[model samples]
Target: MSALQEELILSSPYQEFEREEWKDLNGQFNLNLESTDIHSLHALNEPLNMKEIEEIYFPLAHLIELHIKNHDTIRDDSNSFFQRNQQKLPFIVGIAGSVAVGKSTTARVLTKVLSLLPHKPKVELVTTDGFLFSNKVLLEKNIMNRKGFPESYDTKKLLHFLSAIKSGIPQISVPMYSHLEYDILEDEEQKIIEPDILILEGINVLQVTSQKGQNNKVFVSDFFDFSIYVDALEKDIISWYVNRFESLRATAFQNPTSYFHKYADMSLLESREMATQIWNEINKPNLHDNILPTKYRADLILQKGSDHFVESIKVRKI
Candidate 1:
């Protein structure tokens, strides 16, 4: 068989669209987000420009709005059929990707866009960093180097919190995490109070974890109304991570309170070498073994180019 035939047979279940094709769907929507808004929503050291937002995220937000409208209609019909009224639960959107892939920026942009819709629904953004095992716990368990892997998280607690949200609990409080400290804040929590939409952003949000001999556990993605996976080639991601590492050394890592402050004192060459080593030894393995495996489970996948622009989108084929 020809190589082209083999490639065709290996095509994904997702319906792929190039950037031009996807952005054309944004059509007459007044790209109302200003330059300042895009800058504020963007991540530090990530190249997210106004053009990228308008061409990529604006159309995605519009698509999500359509999905929410259809969901509401179906929900109303179900309620009417039962002759009963039930409290509306927030539509949960899970954003998953490799480290340095810009999932946080994507989540922030989506939250702002959804909240600014015609109905102006309440929107809240939460990250799964809070769901991770505290630094103390990791040290005790001797898994400090494996931090972003699934085993380093409090999976049961995360599951419980998500379950409460979907069960229509009036308010839920999640532990807060501090990037400056690179640890969970034992004394602080973020309260999410009855939002109209909840955007859960994290590296492992779409991952499925199960023991080798156990088959009874459900995954975190089961509760998601929608899920997004931010994707890029591994080589591009390594470059991005190294760039971010250097930037953080000059900025946040300089803070005495920063967990990575040790790197702040290192020379430029040393820092770059350490950054590449860490990425190769730790982050790359996690992406290959844990994160990338979950990409097909996403409702939508944003595939980014080496230049940090979203170049394609793959919506799961229903």
Candidate 2:
């Protein structure tokens, strides 16, 4: 291991174990988890299995649990010292990565696994899509092609949402976006109430920006107790994006009201060309300009092989 990797392991509260060692460690948990394996979390069409989850994700969850416990203890100690009544903030985890890198899947799986922990209370997963500007706003700004760009999102709204969650607010409402419609829904919302853990996933969660003659403030990453970046080769991610686009074309895009319905009847060759064009013109540039630059800010990086399996992990030392 490199010095960085060694430092990460030493600083972390959880023990690092190989894939085969997970079964032995299973008894350590009081809860009966269906499968701690990483592969089980991948989409049904994607190839994944238990061993990947054990070696890669389980350890990360253990570390998160430890961090939550330590945070609670410190909060209690501080409250006693100050003799004040303040609710402890929820442990927030941020997941960031380029599109098609499977960050969403990672966020969902982490939420499930963390919630299954014996001591965990309520785990809520929120995606940055909820904070994106309405399609009308993007259209008005003539930024429809740049929809996924950082400027296309309402950063102020996202910050306020995180602030609300971090303040231990009793209830919060998050807007819902529909990928099929390619816009925020009219009357849909997600309600979160007093979560113990909040998982926030987005393409630019770790992005940093500064205004003229002022220090940077309120980055999405500032609210995170821990952050993860899912990584893969640019070519691999582009290929995955194309594949996913084709899959969506066959299913969701076929819906008459779908934003992409126009592409539903295209030939396979035409679809491939369209997918490649979109990636090269839109998604890839956004990744380079807004997303990939934030990789170093992640507390942990999950590197995936060409086959889409997480082959290695890099945890930054505290």
Q: Estimate each model's TM-score.
A: 0.94, 0.88
**What local lDDT does model 1 show for residue 74?**
82
| Local accuracy of candidate 1 as per-residue lDDT tens digits, 3-120 | 9987875676778899999998885554477778878888877877778878887789888888888888888999999988877889999999999998988999889888887788
Runs in model 2 lying further than 4 Å from the true structure:
1-27, 30-41, 210-216
Best by TM-score: 1
- Candidate lDDT scores, in order, read 0.89, 0.82
- Least accurate stretch of 10 residues (summed lDDT) in model 2? 14-23
- What is the Å distance of residue 209 in model 1 from its true position? 2.4
- Clashing pairs for predicted structure model 2, backbone only: 37-53, 38-53, 39-48, 39-49
Task: Using lDDT, give the best candidate's number.
Answer: 1
